[model samples]
Target: MNKLSSAIWFRQEQDTLILEIHVQPRASRNQIVGVENDRLKLRITDAPVQGKGNEGIIRFLAKEFRVPKSYLTILAGARSRNKRIAVRSPRVYPDWMTGSIQRALFKIS
Candidate 1:
């Protein structure tokens, strides 16, 4: 594991990146709001009714990580604000993440 994996918000396992996220639905905008209680915080404009928030999270994360929506998965907390996501072979890391994480994403083995 790389140094960033030790962080509670995210970890890298093989080619997959696992993220611990706390989402606040029906917010003023859709954006990453840093970490809270060891999980990455996010504010989404979509309401939490009828899985709209979950879909919104997937769409937002897909764009942030530069991955296809099919490459993203909600591993846990689909029915709640707290969620765990897995990104397979992500092409890029969001600028909000630490610089080390950004470098790690493109590091060749």
Candidate 2:
């Protein structure tokens, strides 16, 4: 979970859960890998060029969580693959949302 370039809980205005994500842009596909000591590993089908990876991240999560991309915003690290995503708009996440979110972004190790 630590490898995650970014992780955050929805509607937690204070003491919110946040993670640092490391995106493997232009991966063969989209998947999530579990915590490996420090960083969260993520694989995306979109190419790393032109913010595709970043866009893909939002798309993937929106689909998985059945939310709109507008609901999920990249708070930081837009230019860089490592980003801080904040779950907003919807204000609610599904059960096991974190695990599902990770899986949506990376492959299980």
Candidate 3:
């Protein structure tokens, strides 16, 4: 298993990192809610139409991970709420993410 295998929300893919997200589009604000079943629950203000929400997701991820927008890509589920995205060369991983990962590991062990 990979270093992040204990966590469900994301995993390292070679140099890049992959995020499994459950997006709540048209939300009042954009933010990361929590982790569930190995997926990160994200709330975004944009509606899920014409890829607007998808764009918002990329922007949010870029800022959160401290990477450029171009570094993030929608790997799958562009239209669906459940999305798999890849982020290249991230410079940050917030405490909430590491806490979640620890909780997941605690649950496993």
TM-score per candidate, in order? 0.85, 0.63, 0.84
Q: How many steric overlaps does candidate 1 have? A: 0
TM-score rank, highest first? 1, 3, 2
Ranked by lDDT, top first: 1, 3, 2
Candidate 1: deviation at residue 107, Å? Answer: 17
The TM-score obtained by model 1 is 0.85
- Kindly state the number of residue pairs that clash in model 3: 1
Give Cα-based local distance difference scores for all models. Answer: 0.85, 0.62, 0.83
lDDT of 1 by residue, 17-90 (tens): 99999999999999987767778889899999998999999999999999999999999999989999999999
In angstroms, the error of model 2 at 66 is 1.8
RMSD of each: 4.8, 7.4, 4.7
Q: List candidate 1 stretches off by more than 4 Å.
A: 1-6, 100-109
